[model samples]
Target: MPTSQPTPWGRARGAALGLVLVTVTAGALLGGCQQGQQRQQQGETRRQEQALQAAATAQRRDLDALVERCQAGQAELVTAAAALSAAEAALAGLEQRRYSPLPRPPAPDPAVLQRYSISDQELELERHQQALQAWEQEERGRRSRWREEQRQERQRLQARLQRQRQALSAANPAVLSPAPEAKLNREALAAFRSCKRETLASLGS
Candidate 1:
């Protein structure tokens, strides 16, 4: 009779304990799974970030050279344009001069009918002047074309430089990493120190 009286309370306590144990076990398993997943994701992020950095570093020297060449081309283009303008102005001035009319020479002697000899010299001079003007114009056109081509080349180089820089930034670990920029900055500092030490060692040897 006494055992029967306590049966309901004992059964209730066992059921409550079993439920608590099952819940705790499930929570611990779930925590483990979450931690594993987090670690896996972090490893993947690290791999991706490392690949991007390597790619950027590999291209750095080439990109720097391209930027330098582009700047030089831009300077050359500026000088060429100035020279072209000066040449064009001189050409315009020469073209504006009026063509001289043929000059009449003195009438031949009337004593004996003599043929009037045309001054072929004047015609030759005129022809030379025309040819010189044509050459100047052609030279100006060629210079202008060269200037345009240089400008286009400079623009293409600039665009390529910008694209390379943009790609480098996009692939930056600071952008992709879960760590803050400040931490990445510290890492960079450490890397720089290591590189400097290595360089010094090589030089000393």
Candidate 2:
């Protein structure tokens, strides 16, 4: 037996159904692609966030280490300053003693003077002058030596202070801030700024 041919309306309905199926399939495929793109974008955003977080953490650790070093340098500076002050005081005392005049000897009685010297007091005056000269010579030598020692001490302390200052400057958080070209999120930037402020305050800079 021969099968009956489909009517125009039936054929049209079938075509419409096929078109709908095609449309639905296309729509599903497009939706899937959009969803995949969205997921990929989310993953990228997560990665960027993670990287920013890690950078911030590293920055904090670096700041902490630098601050520790700066504190240690400051302590060393304090010790050096104390030592310098003591050295200066000692030098000053030596200077005062060196400059101080010796006590003048009282004049001898008339009887003793006649027995020691015939008429002129020039002999006694010469002796007194010679003694003063000798004392001054000795004192000048001591002062010169003390001055040299003080100079050496001062130079040593000054060098130590300079080194400490350089160390502290190197450890400055502002100097150590992240690169300007770095892509950081708002939260990470805020964290970095906060850390810098705290570090500066702790270092008393």
Find the 10 residues in a row with the least total lDDT in model 2: 181-190
TM-score on alpha carbons, each prediction: 0.34, 0.42
Residue pairs in clash, model 1: none
- Candidate 1, residues 1-205, lDDT tens digits: the string is 4454647889899999999999999999999999999999999999999999998786665555544543444444334334434544544554464433333333334442233235554555566667767766777777677667666755665555444333333333221124222122334323323334343233223
Tens-digit lDDT string for candidate 2 (27-137):
999999999999999999999999999988987787777556545555544444344446546556645553344554554456766767554566776776787778778
The local distance difference test score of each candidate is 0.52, 0.60
- The alpha-carbon lDDT assigned to residue 174 of candidate 1 equals 27
Off by over 4 Å in 2: 77-205
Off by over 4 Å in 1: 1-6, 68-79, 87-205
